[model samples]
Target: MESILATMGDQLGQMLVVLGGALAVGFAGSGSAWGIGLANEAAAGIMTEDPKKFGYALVLLALPGTQGIYGLLVAVLAMQKAGLLGGGSVALTVWQGFGICCACLPIAIAGFYSAIWQGKSSAATILMIAKRPEQIGKAVILPAMCETYAVFGLLVSILMLNGIKL
Candidate 1:
């Protein structure tokens, strides 16, 4: 039984590697997409009021998108260590492979949810700003509050990878 488990782990390691990478990419990208969506929606709304702010709004929307990039970076770093891009050549243990997969989950899950929540939050703030421009700073700060953990998650994944044998 132990031998079978080990064999399965070895075989599953590759799958986990790919899965982790995909999850990282998917999770972070989803957040970015939603953030971009919020920005676009806001831009459309703002453009109706003043077209000059379009560029500024675009930057604001894209700011939340940095989370996804961080997730992707962690995934890529893990994959690189896994030799997906020809870096990791060592044989990975079941524990190591499992750790690699687990490491990615934090940012993926956090980024995915936070971005969406932030988007809605952004929309509300933007709307509030529409009524009173003085609320813009508060609006911006609100979404940022959600983004810290996603960044931390990304950091965790990177550190987790750093400790992995891969």
Candidate 2:
């Protein structure tokens, strides 16, 4: 009976760790899709007006996609940390699994929100550059401001994941 209960507990912990990886990928991927869509809509409009601005609009449109990549990085790191990536296993208590899940949340939440707001900022910058194409340099900076938070989130997630010993 004791061995059976311990097995069940270990299974639950493994499941929770998998869930964390899924959440990181799912939420961040969805946000990237939405954010990219938002920016593309604006880019399409600007391009329609002035086809020549495609080069400028493309740069701004790509900014929001970074959050998804950051999320993926965290997911991969977490999986590697948990020994799930290399077809190995780690004995994690439920508390340890929960801690890993919580660690992933910073990047998951930040990536989602930051990508969205960055898209909005990118859209605005797209419109701005439509008129003053010469201001492309300055325009890129606006959307980049929103990216800062995503970077911070990624950093925190990495640090947290590293702190959790298997």
lDDT on C-alpha atoms for all candidate structures: 0.77, 0.88
Runs in model 1 deviating more than 4 A are: 1-11, 131-138
Residue 54 of model 2 has an lDDT of: 95
State model 1's lDDT.
0.77
Tens-place lDDT per residue, model 2, 75-135, is 8888787888877788888988888888888889999999999999999999999889999
For model 2, name the residue pairs that clash.
none
TM-score, prediction 2: 0.93
Measured over all alpha carbons after superposition, the RMSD of each candidate to the real structure, in angstroms, is 3.5, 1.8
lDDT of 1 by residue, 11-124 (tens): 777668778888998988888798769767976898799776665565457666877887788788877877778755657665677788888888898888877777766666
- The local lDDT score (0 to 100) that residue 68 gets in candidate 1 is 82
